[model samples]
Target: MLGKAWQFARRHKTKIAAVSAITGGLVLAGKLAESKFKQWQEEETRKMLEQIKKQHHYENTEKTSNETLKSLFPALIKTIEKSLDSEPILERIKNQTGNKIELWNELKVLSFARALAMIITGTQLVLLLKLQLNILSGILYIKQPSQVLSSRLQERFMALSQNFISFSVPKICEQIREKMIQLLALSLKEKFTITQLEAFFQTTLLQLDLPGFQKLIIAPDGDHISQPLNPDEHLLLDDLINNIVELLEHEDYAKIFRIGLQTSLSNVFDYLAESYLSHESYKENGLRSEVRLPVAKLIPILNQSITVYQSVLHALIKHYTIREYSANIYESFCQAPPDAIAKPSLSTLWPF
Candidate 1:
């Protein structure tokens, strides 16, 4: 429906453009008028508020003595023992502010915010919670310190940790990918338009063994791929595999893979967590000690990595003559211009 309307407007672009301009002008005028009206209303409201203040003789009330407040408010103040029947003198308060509604609105908002904060923080229940914690600690291990968590709790703890890590993998992967993309943006040109991708895809298609594949699709009775695709009566079938590949390439694979990873991990998370709990190491004694041995485990891995790296360096030096290359580089650097040194290399065309 919208497409047809757009087509119609496109056909009568001049008329449509004029209409749009007029409509936009009317909207702008309406907005300006509304703004002016709002200003006028605010001015009228201010004037009305002033008129109300004047009519109520609030200026006279402002001259009330401190002695009068001490006498009147003190009398009005209610004791806890005495059945309270004291109310604020609304007129006196209203006279002082000359804005009853505004004062009440401010008070209501402030009270609500204070109450919300109190509830959120559990300020009133802190003492109760402290007592509960003390009792639980006593019950759990008043004598034993290290046995604060039981075997059951250890299981729960492991399970909780496994679940947390397993579930968090998607988010972790997402952040890693995001950071990778940020780094990639520095080097990789973000030019992934469909036209460019399709051209690339077609070029890749030309390189494939499509003719060999087409031979298999031929009818067994008599037909062999003479034109590679021109079948009986020249009823040439379009290359289905190429069509499929084209269709696949045209899809948002990045989006598809991201969604698939998230969905796949959602199911995998539970399986991974279950497997972690069932692992023999976790079932054995001293779960806490094992969990704490990350640094010990990491040290060996680090040492292995260092050894591998050192060995790789040795191999590269032996095989690639990297040291010789470095010496050649140093000599070239020493001979070249100090500020703008040129790199010297063996010219492949004239190495001798």
Candidate 2:
């Protein structure tokens, strides 16, 4: 029976070959199409993941996470509190200024502002990235394989030929080849500004000198002030301090920083203290009284400023670490599904 069936198939070689070719072509095409579709899907998934990772890295540091935050917060708060020991300085500022109400009021405002800024900024940074991740996931997962293939084939084959016969086997195959190229190009160029912004902020933060608080401020000029040991000293200090400010103001960095300021009081105080301390003349005065002016009475201001600065720095580090962990969570969402749907099939040319 099998031999007779083989002979019958052989006798109708042209028809058999055509049918075989069609069958084989469909199977091969289906597999190839499936593979290509899967590849495209995976590539899209990978790209989205990379974007999420980039955004994560940018908006939040590697250190930001609940576990890390939990571990670090107590220690950080303790350190800041210890450094701030406001009692001695508060008394000094009150005695020297004789305007206790005004001075304390200003310190109170500054402290409050600082805390508010850090909380807000940190929250905004984390939330902004989270929203971006959600948007990206929706875009990546919403696509259907059949729809994509149909759309692609239509755009390619429709433009080439109108009639069925003109759409020869080889020609149709050629069209698929062309469509694949177009699809690849489109996928590669897809925009993700959130990722870009995140990357910018992360890179900028990495470049900042977090511990060099004293170097940021320059001392007021005086005959007693010591000259720079080297010719490059002034330039070095200027570059370092300028770099920090520059990083803070960068489009992406500024956006995250502003958001972070809104989330945490520490962040706001950090910004204020850093900005004020970076001035060249402030360090020169050394929070002391001058014969020409009673600015010496403002020593409490300097002390309070330092305390706020320390507190903000500690808080930022803690918050940053937590954000880093959150970014990792966003990254896990990028993996491709295992049981994806089947690809579309092409109808064959047959006589009615």
Candidate 3:
């Protein structure tokens, strides 16, 4: 039996070696396959993480822009507050080489200019916001194709803008003119000193809370409900606020809106400065504190300055709210995939 087993072992040597080699190769191949699988999995995970990072960055940018738009009114108000600081105005007077008595009159004109800037800027912000809100309300509940919706919405927004310029501006300006007359007459009768007028202007301008005005303009229980709107229309207004806000969050619209609004405001400031400097009385007397304020003349000048900005506002509204631009915002929302759109909390029709 031992002799037979020894012979069998010797004969099977090559067969045993070949079988051993095959087993070893199979083990190595298994390890290689497992390693490749892990590499592929890691690569996929990295790609997914990158996508998520990109998405978060995009969302954050939009959110930041939207918040900036929302806070613009307050931001501009603060800017005016800083620009009109009494110290700087007084400093300008001190630095002047001309007669101090003549320079003193300049304070009244300067203060008036600053006050008008605040009022006009505030009014424009409010009016623009109101126009946007009204446009949103008009288009919110409409059921139509994107192209048709966009065209109709643009027409509606433009019509509202025209109405605002034609009817609203004059009426609002009249009220403003009357208020200015009263304020100026009272100041003159009291013989407000240059320092005292500066103080008054600063106090009055700083008291303007643009956000407070916004809340009054849009709040559900506020004066905007003078007309009897249906329940759905009321709800639509709330939804429209959200939609318009989200629309402004689009980066393109946000950038353009900011630039246009800032440009318009700057133009108004430049006009006011030029008008004041060119005034015959202003050039002659140099803003004499003792001089009577040309209240009637100043009111019309301020009204004209404010009226010119309406054109810029119209251009802005037309540029962004039209069908061509509106389609882009809708396209952006579509990029989020159908599954994301179907989610209840994320379901928003964000268009102008």
Candidate 4:
């Protein structure tokens, strides 16, 4: 009986343990499913509430918008009726504007009344200007050109010229010199090519109608022509014009041109010196020799180039009117001696 009980206990104990594990797993799965279903129901309830709230808000907005449009509809209809009625008003306004425009056209830019107004205005202006003359006469009286005021003005003019030479003219001269030199260099490079020079000589010396100067030999004027001449005479006559053209084309003539260019270029030194020496600053600085040396150096470069010579010559020469090197930097400024000297001397030069 004890052995049977032991065997029954062992077999039943294994079955009991397996049944308990299965029952526990089923209970856990049921609890998990219930929790998940509750969570899904709550989420669905929240989404449905959000959708209902949005729909309600959208319906309210649409109802308000419809009410506003209904409120404006009568005003819109009235505006349309008014616009439709304005066509005659528009036409009448256009006709009135056309009439006004014709009347305005008849009114000229100037007439008797305008001229009268202008005269009155000019007279008032002249009367107002008299105040300036009166004030000036009271302060700085000028009865005549020999008056103290006139003398003062003359002295001021001289001082102004001096100041310009001392301060302004140097810089102005530097700019002008730079511009002139640059223009000269460019003109030389462009205009004075050897090819152009040859063409110029050919045009000037060799007549286009008679390249061989046959007309000169034959005398187209029907005068001073020795007809039926000897062979030597014919040879001399025909050869004379050709000989001159040949001589002109000679290398010796080119050498002569170079020599002439050098001589003329050398004269430029005197010209520049004369111009520089005209300035009071040059005399004070004693830069005459300094100026001449540089000019002498520059003249030789011209000898090496006929282009340089012609360009400089072109810049120097004038037609109809003559030009002199006169600077007017102080034209607008009246520089009394005291005013010129009173200004800070260091103001002329600012160091960076």
* TM-score to native of every candidate shown: 0.16, 0.28, 0.34, 0.23
Candidate 2 regions off by >4 Å?
1-13, 37-61, 64-246, 255-352
lDDT of 3 by residue, 1-352 (tens): 9999989989998998899999999999999999999999999999899667645544443343334334454454444444433345467666876666444444444445444554544444433444353333223223232522344333333233233333343343333334444454342224333334345544544443423322322222322223454464445344444544454444544444444445555555455555556656657878744443343344335434434444443443344333234333333443433321211122333333
Per-residue lDDT over 215-275 for candidate 2, one digit per residue giving the tens place of the 0 to 100 score: 2222223332333333344443343234333433334444444444433543433444443
Colliding pairs, model 3: 105-287, 105-288, 105-289, 106-287
TM-score of 2: 0.28
Ten contiguous residues with the weakest lDDT in model 2: 343-352
Total clashing pairs for each candidate: 0, 36, 4, 0
Candidate 3 lDDT score at position 162: 35
RMSD of each: 41.8, 27.2, 13.8, 44.8
Q: What is the C-alpha lDDT profile of model 1 across 117-187, one tens digit per residue?
A: 11111111121122122222222222242333334332332232222222322233233233322322211
lDDT of each prediction vs. the true structure? Answer: 0.30, 0.38, 0.45, 0.32
Which is the winner by TM-score between candidate 2 and candidate 4?
Answer: 2
Candidate 4, RMSD to the unseen true structure: 44.8
Q: How displaced is residue 311 in candidate 2, in Å?
A: 9.0
181-233 in candidate 4: lDDT tens per residue?
33222221132322332343233222222112111211122222223444543
> Which ranking of candidates, highest TM-score first?
3, 2, 4, 1
Model 3 worst lDDT window (10 residues):
338-347
Best by TM-score: 3
